[model samples]
Target chain A: MAILSLAFKSLLNRKLTFFITLFSIAISVTLLLGVQTLKTETKTSFMKSISGTDLIIGSRGASSQLLLSSVFHIGSSTNTIKYETYQDIEKLPAVEWAVPISMGDSHKGYTVIATNLSFFDHFSYANKQNLTVQSGSIDDDMFAVAIGADVAQKLDYHVGDRIIVTHGGGEIEGHDHDNIPFFVSAILSPSFTAIDQTLIISLEAMEAMHTETHDHLGALPGETLLDSDHHEHHDEHDEDHEQHAAHDKHDEHHDEHDEDHEQHTAHDKHDEHHDEHDEDHAQHAAHDKHDEHDEDHEQHAAHDKHDEHHDEHDESHEQHAAHEHEDTQDQRIARLLKLKPENINAIFVGLTSRHAVLGMQSYVNNFQGEPLTAIIPAVALQELWQFFSLAESALNIVTTFVVLVGLLGMLSIILMSLNERRREMAVLRSVGARPSHIFGLIIGEAGFVCLTGILLGVILLYAVLLILQTPLANYYGFYLDINMLTSNDLFILLTIQCSALLIALIPGALIYKYSLSDGMNIKF
Target chain B: MINLTDLSFAWNKQPIIDIKELTIKKGEHLFIEGPSGSGKSTLLSLLAGVITPQSGDISILEQPLNLLTASQKDTFRANHIGFIFQQFNLLPYLNVLDNITLPCSFSGIRKHKALSQSKNLESEAIRLLNALGLDDPELLQRSVNELSVGQQQRVAAARAMLGSPEIIIADEPTSALDSDNRESFIKVLFDECQKADITLIFVSHDTSLKTHFKHSLKLQEINQATIKEAV
Candidate 1:
């Protein structure tokens, strides 16, 4: 007790130095724990993103592929299953529910998803969790869209607001449905997923757009935009000229007549640069003239080449058009086969039996539909964890490095002060203190300093995370969900304290070694 | 009582103190004088058990000092010996009362004797301060720094005399004092030691104070040892 009092007194004499060490250690600890906490939370949020969905019965494809494309907004589908497939799959004995997703539209930068009210009612994420309503109701009308929490917050949209949607995803798309704008029906609370960045609508809305008659611009008068051929050509030439000028600006380094080379690539005006429409017109004129006999051979060769080239180009274009036709056909077939007029992308299932996974799996295997599958969220998530586990390991490495640096800084400070404290130690020894007692004093000093630092670190970290939560959710669609320390935090805190205790000993051991060697020669 | 026989001391192979035989009876006020390098401080250290001799044995109160361990030496010093260093012996942070009672706190036997003496050590400290001719009321409660050099020395003397330790070692206690203060301080110290029946081993290079001590020995004549044997 006396030793403790004296140690405190000694520290008070050097308050500035001790406090500097305390805060440095505190900062290092906070960074370490903060990195660790954020990493764990990211993995957790990813796993929780698709909770309510029990069985995702889509067109026949890899289960993994279907999940990534439908749920995560990654990759593309190989083939869309016919609506007949969904109808047949929905009739199985063990099957409780099914939802078909119609993909291929974007609004601003958000994905425009076509699904029914069942998606809002049944889809769960983060261990079969349901979505919590913040405001407004689920979407019901065609041309009515429910936006995700992140999308709504970012765009500042509320119910009754109208927004134009594009036929493809992302903010940079050129076309929009301004003539048939969608009214915002509801806004979801933040779920920290691709869902948070999606625009939810009914399949009827998708069908209605397809059925509507299109204008020469492939859109309604005020909605669609056309790409003018003449203006496009002029823009291309302007871009080429700009590039040529830029090349000329840097031509001083080029000694081999680089300016002429730039002009050739930029604007040769040769046969290779002939416009497609001009070439077609020229080929038609050549075939009509049946020119002079010698000229006839040259004209015939050019016409045959142009014809052959046009045929190849048409073939590729036809192939693309055929694929698009098949996609449209499949979408129509799937819609006609739907038991209800509503469209749902996925279904969340809760079974009284724990064998829900096996039942769902067997039901899908025997399914007479195009191709259907059931996914146990836990199993799928554990497999997905392999990818995110790298982040976890990186966090561990960073945390370990931070703790080591903190300990090193502390050790260096204590070691530096040892020479000055030698006389103080001798005085203590002269006062009937045992060697162990002296050793305890040093260890106690370190423990006191580090324990204070750890407590301070926890407080600082809590405040910082709280301050950053809203911005983090807005910028990254990750709702940090920070609160007072939970059980997991307690376990983490224990680990931190243990590390500090272990590190504090480094200086204690050094002091003990010094005292032993110096013996009576140590000044008093 | 203290005795030494065939004692040889050295400092890194150079002899410093070589004494064939010496005996100090109880209550003997011995004055030890030597030129510089005569090992007066070394002899005092050995008596105080700060260091052990290289050969032979020195006994205090019939107990062999060399046989005691380092911790035992600390205990023995706190209980049986009082030291008055040249200057600045008192802990700067402690007040006059705490500095006076420090030895008793370290050694239980001394604490018992100190508690049973004139009054609780505070009153005894007050008595010793008065006996030393320091009558200033403000000086008693003030920190050690607030006192003059002479007043501080008187406080040190009073602290050293606490619990009446059998032996008092004063190493040039008056060296830092003015001439008048020095003479008066010396008189007060000797008078107190005499009244307590304590043995005094006072070391100084000044020969003028020789008349005050009953027994006096020049360290060079009495200790014919060189630095080699004193290590």
Candidate 2:
């Protein structure tokens, strides 16, 4: 303790120089720890970007390539999965749900995803946090599309604004879907995932745009939009009578085993039911018209006290009944158009039970008619990281080098200051401090400076994280949580402190040697 | 009491110190005069138990210092010796009291001796400071840097005399002071050493200070290496 005080006093005697030295160590330590934290957070956000879904089914090749292209929207897929194959796998009993993703388009720099409305229901990220529409609604209209939070922020888009997706790559292509421009029906809230960088549209909407010529795309946008909007209103009418009419879209797709011939069979089954319902409804309509005067006379008495005129109310009621009969015909045709997905690039699958995941994975991998790959998301992500571990290792090497340079600065500072401290050492030596005490003095002082530096570095990193969290999340979709320290951080801090102690010993030992050898001030 | 016999030291085989015999008893004040580069500081380093003699032996208080390891010699010096430098000897960051009591922390003998004379280390330091004519209580808590050169010199002297070590070596300690402060410094030093019965070895090139000591010697008379160099 006494020798430590002496060392402390010696340092305080030269406060300005030592303070600068300490500040240098603090700055470099911040950079080193900051890099380490960024690496961990980046890896975690990447992994948590898409969760809950069990498999990503695409044509066979490198799993990393598939993961990058499918989940991260980076590069391109190895091959597209057949839409026919997708429908078959979805039919399997082990499957709970599936989202077929077909792509090769972008809005500005953001990727454009073609998926069914079920994607808004089934797609998950950041661990089961579902994609939520912040503004507007997810409609079934083919031309209506939803934009992600980051995409909307960057493109300065709002609900009802029309945008077109580029046809080929994100950029470097003049061809764009200029004819069938999409209106933003919804804008999603940020999920800190790949979804934030995507513009999502219904699979049929993408198909509809592709089917049109560039000139025709914009020409008939008004007519198609009106038709799709009318279809949406009619579908809501089924919700009012939902108990009888509500059919699960999944069951409709699941029970049918017929392939390309499925359209006729399914349409006939529905057509027969509609015919029977129309006959019953027509008979009721004729009977209601005959009794219309009598019914209005009784209803008029009931509503006469509530409103001024009875004829006005009767006229509105008759018009609504007439419209309802015509709307059902439009709905039947629109419902048939809902199942028009011809192809998809990849499918995200969730098994009926967690245990069924592995069995179904291999069955699909060695699938009978064609080669395919079914990847367990967690395991595939792990493999992808392993393949790219070289980059991570390279990053590690750079941070370590930076920390070493910082420590060396600490070492050199103490060593340079030794010249002026020689007389002080001799004075202490004269008053009973041994060469070892002098040694401990220098080492202890160095350790103190390093420990302070480490603390300052950690605090500085968190402060920067706190300040940048919102902007990064809003613009880049990187939601950095400042709380919690990973084991890697703990290990790095421990290593830095240990190295501080070890490095201090070098200068300590050198001074001890000189103190032992020479006379006053110990010329070496 | 300290004794040396046939002591010799060399720097790169060039001799710096060559003393056949030298003896100083307890409570004796001796002034040793030497010119610049006469190995005066080298002799002090040897006597302070920092470096061993190349070819001879030194004994202090009946203990054979030549046989002790460097660390043991360090312990010996910490317990028994005090040193006052020409200037800038006090550790600047420490308060005067801490500077005075520092040696006791390194040596249990000095600590117990210091503790026995007063209530604690601080009071013991105050007692020594008072005897050295620095009686101001506020002076003890202030940093040594706040003191003037002469005051700093007195604090260094007070530190060396704390716990009343058996030997006090002053290496031109008054060289940085004005003549008036130099006289007062010598007076206070002699008075404290007399009261505590401390053996004093004061080395300086100034021969005028020799009259104050009971016994004195010139480097050319006692040191064979210096005589050879002079010839």
Candidate 3:
């Protein structure tokens, strides 16, 4: 105890040099622990990006590329899967639920994902946790879009604000879907995953936004729009008209499923258009007779006529009755604008049982409708993490070298002080301190400095982590937990402390020899 | 009492100390004076058991130091001897009280002896400081570097005289003191040694200070190595 106190006082006497050495060690320790934490947390959050899903199926390509594009939003898929193929997979016996996703659109640098209500129902991440809406509820309206927490915060979007989406991943000239802007209907809570940086809308809205008829629809004459009865009637059959117009204009550019559906729909619609043209003239005459009704009442009258047409044609009476309960003008127009999806980028699949994942993966790989690839998310994440292991090891090696440099600095400081402390050692010897005591004093001083340095490093790491938490989650979707100190960290700290003690031995031995030779003789 | 017989010591094959016989009775104050490099410091090192003689045996308090192992010699030195140097006698890092009590921290016998005199080591250090004519209460806690040279020598005297060691070997302890301070410092040192009945061996290159001691010898009279170097 006395010798330790003496060592401490001696270091206190040389406060500037000692504190500089201590600060260098502390900084090195912070870098080491910081790198370690980044490596571990990144791997953990990366693996947690998508979980609880049995498999992910996409157009035949590299599984890693598919995972990166679909789950991480890092790149684009090479090809798209036919919507018919997704329907087939959804109908498989082993599949519990499957959510189809359409990508290749962006809203101000944030990816826009086109999915259905099934995505909100079935998608889970980070231990089977579901995405939650923060303020508003998800609506079935085609133009109603839900944004993630990060998207809402970054773009400053609210529930009613409308945003224009670009056709591809970037804002290319003439590719903005300005005619069909999407309004934010819901904002999702933070999931600490890629979902937190995305804009989600129904696939039907995505189909309508990309169709050429909507582009022309936005440029319709003002007189046509002012004619309320005709405009409402025109909005009622807008989906069919857009589909037929797209089929007639760009038949070869669509998928085989879309062409086949278009062919059947075009024949039915060709006859229906002629019949509906006369019926629409009759309805216009009837609406003129009821011209005493106000504009609001006139919209209700048009809805009643639309419901009558639905009863006589393809839709059921019960469906029409259900629509009448919540049929606002916007909802009515949204229903008309919704179209069936022709193709999708990928599908996230969930199974009734975990044991069936491998079997389902093989089934998806051998799918006959079109070439497809399916992968277990966990396995693919592991493979991806292995690719990062080399970088992780390189980082660790660099930090380890930094710790070495810190220890070497301490060693050099101690060695230099030894030259000036020979008289002190002789004084100690005269007062009956053994050579072993001198040796212990040096080692003890180093141990003390190193232990304090490590503690300071931990404190500094936590401070930095606390300051960067929100920015990291907002920018990179990295959620760093401050309270996580694994046994691995303890092991590394222990190794550093032991190495410090061992390194102190160099100067300890030198001073020990000096004390022996200079025995009781004040050399300086 | 201290005794040496036929002691011979060499430094890098050059004889630095060669003594035929030396003895000092209990409680005797002896002064050994010599010129610089005339083996005064070397003789003190040999007497303190810090270095072993290559040929002869040194027995202090009837224990043969040559027969003891290096570590045991250290323990024996700690228990039986106290040392004072010319200047910088106190470790600058410790306070005046801590400097005076330092020997008690290393030696169990000295600690027991100090405890027997006072309630604890601090009071015992105070008692020694008071006897050495440094009664300032604030000076006990002040850093040793804050003291004047005379006060620093007094603190060194207190440390060497604490726990009543049998021998006090002071190497040119008065060389750095002024003429009046040197006399007063020698007076207080002799008073402490007489009170404890300690045998004092004071070595110096200054011959004027030898008048203060009853028994004094010059290195040329007894050290053949220095005489031979002179011839």
- What would the per-residue lDDT of candidate 1 be over residues B1-231, giving only the tens digit for each residue? 799998877766777778888899999998888655788766776776766688989999998998898668768877888877666656555677766776766677877887787657777778778888876665656788777778878888887888888988887788888989989998998898889899998888888888888899988887877553222
Name the candidate, 1 or 3, with the larger lDDT value. Answer: 3
Error of 1 at B167 (Å): 4.1
- lDDT tens digits, residue span B1-231, model 2: 689999998776778799999999888999999876788878888898887779988999999898898888888898999999888888767889888888988889998999889999999888888888899999999988899999999999988988889999998999899999999999999999999999999999999899888899997677788523221
Candidate 1, B-chain TM: 0.94
Chain A TM-scores for all candidates read 0.69, 0.76, 0.79
The TM-score of candidate 1 is: 0.71
User: What value does the TM-score of chain B take for model 3?
Assistant: 0.96
> What TM-score does prediction 3 earn?
0.85
Q: Which candidate, 1 or 3, has the higher DockQ?
A: 3
* DockQ of structure 3: 0.68
- Candidates arranged by lDDT, highest first: 3, 2, 1
How good is the docking of model 3, by CAPRI class? medium
Candidate 2 Cα outliers beyond 4 Å, as residue runs: A77-79, A156-166, A169-183, A213-339, A368-371, A520-524, B227-231
Give the Cα lDDT of each candidate.
0.66, 0.76, 0.80
C-alpha lDDT of residue B80 in model 1: 85
Q: Model 3 chain A, poorest ten-residue lDDT window?
A: A278-287
Best by DockQ: 3
* Leading candidate by lDDT: 3
